[model samples]
Target: MTGPVVVGVDGSSACMAAAWWAAREAVDRHAPLHLVHSWTSQPLDVPISQDAHSERLYGREVLRRTEAELLHRHGDLAVTTDLVAAPAAQALLARGGDAELLVLGSRGHGSVAGFLLGSTALRVVGLTRCPAVVVRADDPTVGAGRDRLVAADRDEVVVGVPEPGPAAEALLEFAFATADAHGDLLRAVTVVPGSPGPRAEEERRAWLAAELAPWREKYPKVTVAERVAVGPAAQLLLTSCGRSRLLIVGRRPHPSHLVWKLGPVAHAAVRHAACPVAVVPHG
Candidate 1:
C-alpha cells in the first residue's frame, strides 16, 4: 500500500493514456509514479542484427518522453523511469510486486476485441499480486482539459460485490479507500440470475448491506449506495461503468502452475468497461 504506482509503457497511444491516468492516481495517493518500459531481442527466426540495440534505445526514449510529460502535468509529483530487458508482463509483475497499484493500457477496439486478443494487459492483470488497473486510450475521463478535482467530485466509484465473506473484503476495502480518498460516492452492486421475487430481492439487498457494513463504518465520510439487480453480472456492471470514474472488481487467485484466467465478470470489466477498471486479487 505504501509503494509507488507502477505503469507499463510500450510507446503506444494506449499506454501513454494509461500513464497519464497513473500520474493522477499517484498524486491522489501521494505515491511516486514509476514508468516501466520492457523490451527484448527479436525472435530467433528473425534477423537480430542491431535489433536489440535499437529496441533498447527506443524503450529509453519512450520512458523519457513519458516521464517528462507526467512531470510537466504534475509539477511536484515524484516520478521515476525504468528500462527492463524482459517481456512486458514479466517486467510489470516484477516491478508491481511492491507497488500500491499497477496500471496498464488496453488497445482493444471494443468489447468484442477484448484486450486485443488477451495480450500483455490481460496477462498482467490476471497474475499481478497487487491491484491492477486497465485503462483504454479513448477513455473519456482521462485526457487534457478534464479537471481532476472536478472529476473526482462528480464521478462515482463502482464496485461489484459478489458475495459476503472474507474473499470480498479486499474488493470492498479498495473501493471504500478509493472513494474516501476522492470524496466520491461508492456504488456497491450485486447481480442475481434471472428474475427474482420480492423476497429474493430483499434477501439479496440484505446480503449486500451486510457485506458493506464494516466498510461503511470504517469510512464514515464516504457516501454508499447499494444496488441489487437481476441479470448477468458482467452486463449490469458494464452498464454502471458509464457514470463511474473507476470500476473495481475481484479476481480469485489461481495456482502458479495453471494457466491464468480472469473470472467472467472481471474479464468483462477489464476488457469492456467504459472507464478505468481495477482488478483486485482476493482469496
Candidate 2:
C-alpha cells in the first residue's frame, strides 16, 4: 500500500456507510483516511447555473461535516478532506493516483449531488489505477455485521478463482490475507462451465488443493475451503457467496481496452453479491 485509503463522499447514506467502511480498512492497513467530494461548476452540456457557487459550497460543507463525524468516531486516525472541481468519476480517478485503495458505495442517491456510485462508481472501478472496493448500501455496520456471514458462525472469505493459474494468484493472496486478518476461513471456489462427472469433480478438487497448497502453508492460521461447482460461474458464486464475509474476484488489467474488462463472473458478483466485493486487477 503506497498511499491513504480514499473514499468518495456525497452526503448520502450509502456514501457515509462507505466512508465508515473505508475508515475500518484504513485502520486495518495502517493508512490514513481521505474523504473526497467531487463537484463540477459547469455541466458537460449545459452552461453553469446561477446556483453553481452554492452547490460547490455545499460540497465543501458536506466534506467538512463528514470529516468531523469520522474524527469524532476515530479521533486517533489521521484524516484529510478534499473538494475536487471535476466530474464525479473523473475526480475520483485522479484521486486514486495517491490512494492505496479507493472505496465507494455501490450505488448513490444521484449524480448531481449525493455520492451515488451507480454509473460513476462503475466507470471509476472499470478504469481505476488502484484497487476499488464497492460497499453495498445495506451492508451491516462494524458493530453489527463485521463477522456476520449468512448461515455461518465464523466469518469466511470467499474468492472466485476461475482458474488455478497465475491469474488467480492475486485473488488467492487477498482472500487468504483477509481471512487470516479476521481469523476466519478462506473458501476458494472455481465454477466449471457445465456439469462435471464424478471423475472431473475429483480432478478439480485436486487441482484446487494443489493451487492453494502454498497459500495454506503461508497462512497456517487460515483454514482453506476448496470447491469446484458445475454451472455458470456467476450463478455459482452468487449462490455460495451468501455465507462469506467478503467476495473477491480477479480482473485482467488492460488499460488499452477503453472499457470495463470485468469478466462475466466478476461483473455478476459486483452486481448481485450480498457482501462487499473487492475487484483485484491481476495480469
Q: What clash count goes with each model?
A: 0, 3
Local error of candidate 1 at 58, Å? 1.3
* Cα lDDT of model 2 by residue, 91-130, tens digit: 7788887787888775522231236334556667777777
The top-ranked prediction according to lDDT is: 1
Tens-place lDDT per residue, model 1, 157-198, is: 999987766557999999999998877889998976456988
lDDT of 2 at 140: 42
Each candidate's lDDT (Cα)? 0.79, 0.73
- TM match of model 2 to true structure: 0.84
In TM-score terms, candidate 1 sits at 0.89
* Model 2: colliding residue pairs: 10-115, 108-116, 108-117
Q: Superposing all C-alpha atoms, what RMSD in Å does each candidate have to the true structure?
A: 3.6, 4.3
User: Could you tell me every candidate's TM-score relative to the true structure?
Assistant: 0.89, 0.84
